[model samples]
Structures are given as structure tokens and as C-alpha cells.
Target: MEKQTPPEQDTIFDEAELLGDGYDKHVRRARNTIFVVASVQFVFGLVLGFSGPEESKWISIGIMSIVAGIFAGLGFWASKKPYQAILIALILFCGLILLDVIFDPASIFKGIILKIFIIVYLIMGVNNARQTLRIKQALGKE
Candidate 1:
């Protein structure tokens, strides 16, 4: 009779399985955070658009409100597929920052600071989603 050797345990797989639940929770929290922030931005944009004087600035505010609505919609979709949402959000944020810089150079410093904070927050959410997905893939390989 021939003797068979058992396959060696993979440390990576073991680690992933151990952390699988935690990763799921992390992803959930990140998704929720994104949703909340997006919702807030949408509401704020709406208020700004409507509460402002009926001047030319209202047109700009309306455009901003539209962008915010798109961001909120993206956030809702991101709950299912986070990575894509993160990319789109980052792109939108960058475009907004560029427009602000071009139109209101005097507030460049303030805008840059706010953008940095938002970018960091978005990156953290992206990282959580990515790590959770990676762990899922690793465990699936087992």
C-alpha cells in the first residue's frame, strides 16, 4: 500500500480565517460611514443651493448640489462594491478641489486642508474594504 502525505497548513490562510469576521465588521462600518458622510454632504448642498441669494451664485450652488447628489448615490452603491466607489469619490473630490482653487484662489489653503482630511477619511474606508476583500479571497482559496 502507498502512503499519502497530507498537505501542509498555510499560515496565510489560517490568519485570514481567524480574522474573517473582524474584516467583515470593518467593511460594514466603513460602508456605513461612507453613507452617512455622503448623506450629510447631499443635505448641506441642498441647503446651500436653496438658502442662498437669488443671484448668479445660485447657479454654482445648484451645480454643487448636483455633484453632492451624485456622491450620495455613489455611496449607496459603494455599500456593495467599495473599491469602485472609492475611486469615483476620489475623482469627484479632486475635481471639486481643482474648481475651487481655480475660481477662489484666496481660499486655496482652507480648501486644501479640508480636501486632505476628506482624502484621508476616504483612503481609510478604501483600505478597510480592500483588506476585508483580501481576507475573503484568501479564505476562499482554502
Candidate 2:
């Protein structure tokens, strides 16, 4: 007599749910996208801190360092809580850009292309994160 394989055996994981091939690709991209956000924050902090004017050097460094730390924290959080972390990152990024434009309107045009690219990536991350969550829920995964 032939025996039947268990349902879990047919899935990618032993018990936990896994994203399908296409969804998996999107989710992987989302994870990498979040890392990009964190890395940019870190590089920006270093650059601004070191090259800022002498008078406000310490202040700039302190502020940037804190901002970088927050991004890094969110990056780590993305591994477990992708949707929430990425959403917050996107909002924070846009808010910062808005603040810059408010202080100096011309700043909006500075590296506008890069800003657009980052914003697009963050949006993609948000979409992918939502799909991942939906998949997990549909599979009845915790």
C-alpha cells in the first residue's frame, strides 16, 4: 500500500508558511530596499557630521547620528516586522524632505532624482510587505 506525504512536506517550510516563488522575489527585494534606506542614512550622517560648519559641527553630528540610529533600528525591525518598519521609514523620509524644502525651497531640486528613486523604492517595499503579510495570513501562519 502507498502512503501519503504530510501536508507540511509539500510546503517550503516544516510548519511556518513561505512566500511563493514570485512573492518570494518581491519580499526579498523589499528586505534589500529597507537596508538601502538604512545605509543611506548612515552615509549621510557621516558626511554631514564631518563636513558641517565648525560652529554647528557637534550639533549636526549629534542629530545625524541619532537619525542614522533610528533608521538602523528600523532596518533590523524589518526582518520581523517588514510592513510597519518600512511604512515608518517611508513616512520619515518624506517628512524630512518636506522639512528641507520648507527651510530652503531650492533644496527640493538638489538630488531630486535620487530622492525620487528612494521614494519609489520605499513605496515598492510597502507594497511587497503587504503582500507578504497577506500570504502569511492566508496560510494561517502566526
Highest-lDDT candidate: 2
Over the stretch 1-142, how does candidate 1's per-residue lDDT look in tens digits? 8999978765535664565665556555555555655665667666876787768557857676677678777778877777678667767777777877899887568746655767776767677767766665676742
Instruction: Let me know the TM-score candidate 2 reaches against the reference structure.
Output: 0.79
Name the runs in model 1 displaced over 4 angstroms.
1-33, 36-40, 43-47, 50-58, 111-113, 134-142
Model 1 is weakest, by summed lDDT over 10 consecutive residues, at: 24-33
What lDDT does the true structure give each of the candidates? 0.67, 0.76
TM-score for each predicted model, relative to the true structure: 0.63, 0.79
Q: Which predicted model would earn the best TM-score? A: 2
lDDT of 2 by residue, 33-103 (tens): 65776677678877887898888877887787777778778778888888888889889889989999999
RMSD (Cα, Å) of candidate 2? 3.8
The superposed Cα distance between candidate 2 and the true structure at residue 99, in angstroms, equals: 0.9
Number of clashes found in candidate 1: 0
